[model samples]
Target: MTDSKLAIIILAAGQGTRMKSATPKLLHTLAGIPIVSHVLATARELDAAYTVAVVRHERDALVEVIVDELPNGLVVDQDETPGTGRAVEQAVASLPADFDGDVLVINGDTPMLDVQTLAGLINEHRHGGASATLLSAFLNDPSGYGRIVRTPDEPEQESAADTAARASTPLFGRRVTDRNGRVDRIVEHRDATDSELAIAEINAGVYLFGVSELRDLLPQLTMHNAQGEKYLTDMVELLRRAGSEVTVLPVAESWLVAGINDRAQLSEAAAKMNALIIRGWQLAGVTVQDPATTWIDLKATFEPDVTILPGTQIKGATTVARGAIVGPDTTLVDCEIGERAVVKRSDATLSVIGADATVGPFSYLRPNTILGAHGKIGAFVETKNAQIGDGSKVPHLSYVGDAHIGVDSNIGAGSIFANYNGVTKSETEIGSNVRLGSHNVFVAPVRIGDGAYSGAGTVVRKDVPAGSLAMNVAPQRNLEGWVATHRAGSAADVAAQAALAPQNAVEASAEQPAERTGE
Candidate 1:
C-alpha cells in the first residue's frame, strides 16, 4: 500500500541436502511446475519492482533452468556456501546501485505462502517505520524455533515489586497497538535464557527490512550458532542492541510458518497447497466435486462456470472454455475444449472439441484430432489426427484416423478406416451425408463421395463416387451331385477289399497241396 518501491530476495542458495535427491530440490515439480516457479509467480502477483533469486548449488543447469523460467530476474550466485545471511548479501550486491526501498526476504521453498499475507507484512514493515519486521507465529510445541522475548514496554523500575509483577505476567505477552498491531523482540533458542525458552512465539523466517538498515548491519552477522553458519537471526539481536527499531508481528496462519526440510514435511506442504487451489477454483464457479480425488494442473486455466468432476486429470497447457463440463475419469494434455463441450471418461491429447460437442463414455482422441460443433463421438471409439465436420456422428465401436469427414455424415458401429499399411500411413475422406454400415472396413488412400452408402460387411479397397450404392460380395456356385458320387465310391471300395481277403487265402492253400501230391 506504500509508494515505497519493494524488492524481493528469494533465498534459494541452499542445496537442500536433507531432500536426499540427485536433482536440485527446488527443480522438482509440484502440481506440474517446479516448486520455485510457484514462489516466483506469487512474487509477480504482488507487483514487486524486482525479484532476485540466490543460487549456490553444484549444478549450473539448475540455475539455467530457473533463468529460463523466470526471465525477468537476475540469478545471483553465492560463490561461498556460507548461510542465508550471506546468500542475501550476494543478492544485495546484484541489486541496483540506486535501490532505496524496502527489501522483503522469502525462502524459495515456501511456495504455499499466500500473496495477501505477504502484502500485509510489507505494509506493516513500511508503516511502522522500523528497521525490520519479522513474521512470527505461536506454536504449541516450539522446540527447534527461535523464541520471541519481549522487553517490557516500560522497563521495570529494578525493584523487587516490579520483578514480582513481571514473573506474574504472561511469558510471551506483547502490548497491542491499534494502528501497527502487536510488538516484541526475537531471541534464538540456543541464545535465550531458560526463562525465555518458555515463550511459545517462534520466527517463521519471513523478514522485511529497511534497505538502509540491512546495508548497515549485514556486516555484523557471524558464525556463532551450533551449526557454525552465519545466521540471519543474529541480525535481530544486533539491530536491537544498536537501538534500531525492530518488531515481530504474529502470522495470521500457523501453516505459513512451516518449513520443508524432508520428504514427510514436503508432503504435508503439498497437501496444503493442493487444498488451496481446489478451494479457490470451487469458489470461482468451477465445480470440483470430491476435491481430494481431483488433480488440476497448476497452469491449467478454466473459464468461469466450468464444471470439473472427480477423478479428472487436466494437465500440460490444457484449457476449457466457458460452460464446459469435464471428467469423472478423463485425462487431457495440451487440449482445448470449446464452450459448453462435454468430455467424459476419455483420453485426449493435442485435440480440440468444438462448441457443444459431446465426447465419450469411453473414447480416445489422439493428437491433431478435432471435433466440430454438435458432433458426437460415442462409446468405444478412437480417433487420431482426424477432423470431424459439424453435426457428424461417429457413434460406437469405430476407429477414424488420418481423415476428414463431411458435415452430417453418420459413421456406423464396427466401422474402421484402415489408414496404415506395413510401409506407410494414409488418409480416408468421407463426403457429406455418407452412411457407412456395420463391420465395413474402408482401406485407405480411399474416398467416399457425397450421399454414398456402403452395405454391411463391405470391405472397400477403392473409391466410391457421389450418390452411388456400393455393395461388395463374392459370387457363389452350388456343387449339385458331389455328395452322391462321393458316397457310391466309398461303398464299392469297402466291398472289393472285403472279397479280396478270402480269395487270397484259398489260392495259397491249393498251391501247397499240389506240391505235396507230386512228391
Candidate 2:
C-alpha cells in the first residue's frame, strides 16, 4: 500500500424499495449479521484512519446499530438529495477539512467484498497514481449494469483494404484496450447503443478516490439524466475531462461486488457467505455435517474436533469446545458448551454446559442455566436460572427453575422445582446426595439437607433437615364392598348377587338329598 492515509465512506442511505421490507435494506441480515455490519467489519480490517457511515432511511435505527459496533466512527445523515453522490458529499463534509487522503466509497449492502479484495483495490489505486479507480467485472448477463467503454490501441490507417476490414469488424462498444490494456470510460446500459450494450465488462460500484479530487468534483454533479439523480458514475467522466487519469481494476469474482437489492439477492448473498464460513470451519478441524443445512453465525467459535450435526444454528457469540458434539437439531445463542459435552436436539440460550455433561434429545436450557461436569439434563426437560452441581442429574420430563442442586444429587423424572407462587418467585436448594423421587415438587424457598430422601408424590413446602425423609401422602385405607353397596343396579351389584347364588344352591341340594333317603 502507498503512504496515503485511508478513509472509508459507506453509503447506506437508500430505502431499497425493491426489498419490500419495512426494515432498511442495509439492516437485512446475511449469515446472522446485518449486511451493513459485515461491510463495517471489512472496513475495520483495512485499518482506515477514519470511517464514516451515511444514513438516511431508518436513520435512527441504523445509527444505533452502527454506534454499538463503531462507537468512535463518524455518522453523517444524507440530506434530501437522495443519491449516491449526495450521500458521499455528506460524508465528506463531516470529515476534517485538512484531511486529504484516499477515500474508499462502498455500498453498505455489498457484504461479500472481502478485506483482501478491498486492500488489493486500494493498493492498485495508490500504486497506479490514478485520480480514481473503480472495481469492474465481466458478466455474461450485464443487463442492468453500466458498461465499460475503452479505446483500442490500433493506429488509424488510410488504406482502403484496412478501412474496410476495420469497419466490418464489430468494434462499436466492445472492450477496446489501450496499448497497456486499461479502462477508458463506463457507459450506462440505458444510454449505450446496440453495439455498446454488447460489452461484457460492467462497473462493480466500488471505488477509491483521491479525497481532494472527489471533494472538488462532488459539487459539480448534475441530475440531468433519466433518473434525475446525481450519479457518482458521472465523476469518472468529470475526472477524465480534467486530464486526470481514471482507471478500472477488474475483479475476477463477480459476486464480490454484487449488491443486495431484493429478497432474492439477499438470499444469494447469504448462501455464498454460508459456504465461505462452512469451508473455513472444515479446514480448521471442526466437523460440520451437511454444511448446507447448518447455519453458524459470524461471531460463533468452534474448537477443533467439535462436531456440529445438521439442522443446527449456532448464533451470537456461542462457543463449542473441543470434543463437544452438538445438534441434529439445535439452536444455541451466547452459550458455552464444555469439552466432551453433548447437546442433541436442544435449544439453549445464555447457558453453560460443563465438561462431559449430557443435555437433551429434546431439552430447552434458558438463560443463566448451568449444567455441571458429568451432569445430565435429559429429554423433555426445561431449565431456567438453575445450577446443577458436578455429577448431578435431572433426567427426563422435568422443569427445574430458580434452583440449585448439589453434587451427586439425583432429580428424578417428573420432578419439578415449583419456585414460583402466585406473586413471587423463590429458590430451592438441595444438598449433596439428596434423593428426590419422581413426581416430587420442591415448592419455593425450601432446602433439603445432605442424605435427605424425598418419596414419590412429595410436595415439599418446608425445609427438611439432614438425613431426614420427607413424604406428603395420607396413610393407606381400604373401602371394601363400597362399590356393591353404593352401585346398586349397576354392574358391581349384579356381579355380587350372581356370585352368592352359586354357594347357596350347593348347600340346599346337600340338605334335601339326605332327608329323602331317610324317609
Candidate 3:
C-alpha cells in the first residue's frame, strides 16, 4: 500500500432528473441505507486522511446526511459552473494549502465500491509513479460511457501474458500509440469518431490523482465539450501533453464501480448489494434459507448458528445470537434475540428476548417489552411495555401490556391484563407461581401475590394476598323449567324437556313402542 496520505472526494451534486423525485439521488436508499452513506462508509474504511463530499443540488439536505454519517468529514459546495471538473475543484480548494498527497475521486452514487479495490488502485498509482490513474472496465455494450483510448505497448514493455491475451482476441479497444508507447486521452462517445465508437473499454469514472498536479491543472480546464461542461477526462490529455505518465487500471469486476443514474439502475444496484450481504452472512455460519426473500439491514448483526427463515426482515440495530431461529414471516426492528430464542411469524420492535425464550406463531411485541429466559408469548398474543420474568408464559389469545409478571407464572388462554381504563393506562403485577385461569381479566392497578390462584372467568378488580384464591363469579342458581315456560316450542325448551326426563322413562317408552307418533 502507498504510505502517502489519502483524501477522498465524493461528487454528489448531480440533479438526478432521471430518478424523478424531489429527494437528491445520493439520498435515495438501497438496502435500507442511503446511497451516499454507503459510499462514505467505504471511504472511512480506507482510513483516508480527509474525506470531502461536494454538494450543490439539494445542498443542505445532502450535507446534513453527510455530517450525520461522518461528523468530521468536510463538506464543499460546487459553484454554478456545472461539471465534474468544477466539483473536484471545489473539493480541492477546501483542503489545506500545503497538503500534498494522493486524491481518490469517486461518485456518490456508486455504493458498491469496496475498500480493497480502492487500496489496490492507490497502490497501482504509487507503484507506476503516474500523475493520474484511471479506473477502466470492458463492457459488452459500452453505451453512454466514455471510451478509454490506449496507445499500443512497446514490444519491450509487453509481457508474455499480455501478448497472449491480446493475440487470442482482438483487444476491446483499438491499439493506437504514438512513436513512443503511451496511453492517449479518454473520449466521450458523442465526441468519438466512427472507429472509436467500436471500443468496448469504457471509463469507470473513478480516478486517483497526484494532489499537487491536480490542483495546478484545475485552473486550465475549459468547457469545450458538446455538453458545455468542463470535462474531467480532459485532464488525462493535458497530463500527457505535459510529459507526465498517465496510467490505466482495468477493474476485473465492473459492478464495483458502476454508477446509478436512474431508477432502473438504482434497483439493479440494490439487488446486487443485497446479494452480496446475503452471501457474506452465509459464509459466517448464519443460515439464510431463501436469500431472495430475506432482507437484513446493514446495521443488523448475527452470531454463528443463527437461522433466518424466508420472508424475514431484520432491521435497525437488531442482533440475533447463536442458535436463535427467526422468521418464516417475521419483521424485527431494534430488537435483540438472545441465544436459543425463537421468534416466528411475528413483528417486534424495540424489545429484548432473553435466552431460551420463544415468541409467536403470530404475535406482536411492541416497544419496551422484555421477555426473560425460558418465557413464551404464544400465538395470537400481543405484549407492550411489559416485563415477563423467567419461566413465565402468556400461552395464547392474550394481550399483556404495561404489566410485570414474576417467574414461573402462567397466564391462561383468552386472558387479558386490562391495562387501559377509560381515563388512563395503568399496570398489573403478578408475583411468582401465580396461576391465572382462562378467560380472566385483571383490571389495571391490581396485583396478585405469590402462589395466588384465579378462578376461571374471574374479573379481578382488587389485589389478592399471597397463597390466596380469588374469584368474583356470581353464585350459581337454577330457575327450574323457566326456559320451558318462557318458550314452549323453542330448541332450548325441547332440550330442557329431554334433560328433565327420568333415566327409566327411556326404557318405559321402548317397552310401549306401539304408540301412534302422529297423534
Candidate maximizing TM-score: 2
Q: Report clash pairs, candidate 3.
A: none
User: How would you encode candidate 1's per-residue C-alpha lDDT over 226-295 as one tens digit per residue?
Assistant: 7777677777878878887776766645677587766777778777877887888888778887888777
Error of 1 at 434 (Å): 2.1
Per TM-score, what order, best first? 2, 3, 1
- Clash number by candidate, in order: 0, 0, 0
Error of 2 at 181 (Å): 5.6
Per-residue CA lDDT of model 2 for 45-84, tens digit only, reads 7778888999888999899888987877899988888578
Question: What local lDDT score does residue 73 receive in model 2, on the 0 to 100 scale?
Answer: 83
Q: Write the per-residue lDDT of candidate 3 for residues 149-184, one digit (tens) a residue.
A: 765553333322342243211211122122222467
Each model's C-alpha lDDT?
Answer: 0.79, 0.85, 0.86
Model 2 spans with C-alpha error above 4 angstroms: 1-4, 152-181, 189-197, 476-519
lDDT of 1 at 262: 66
How would the candidate models be sorted by lDDT, starting from the highest?
3, 2, 1
* lDDT value, candidate 1, whole model: 0.79
Better of 1 and 3 by lDDT: 3
Which is the winner by lDDT between candidate 2 and candidate 3? 3
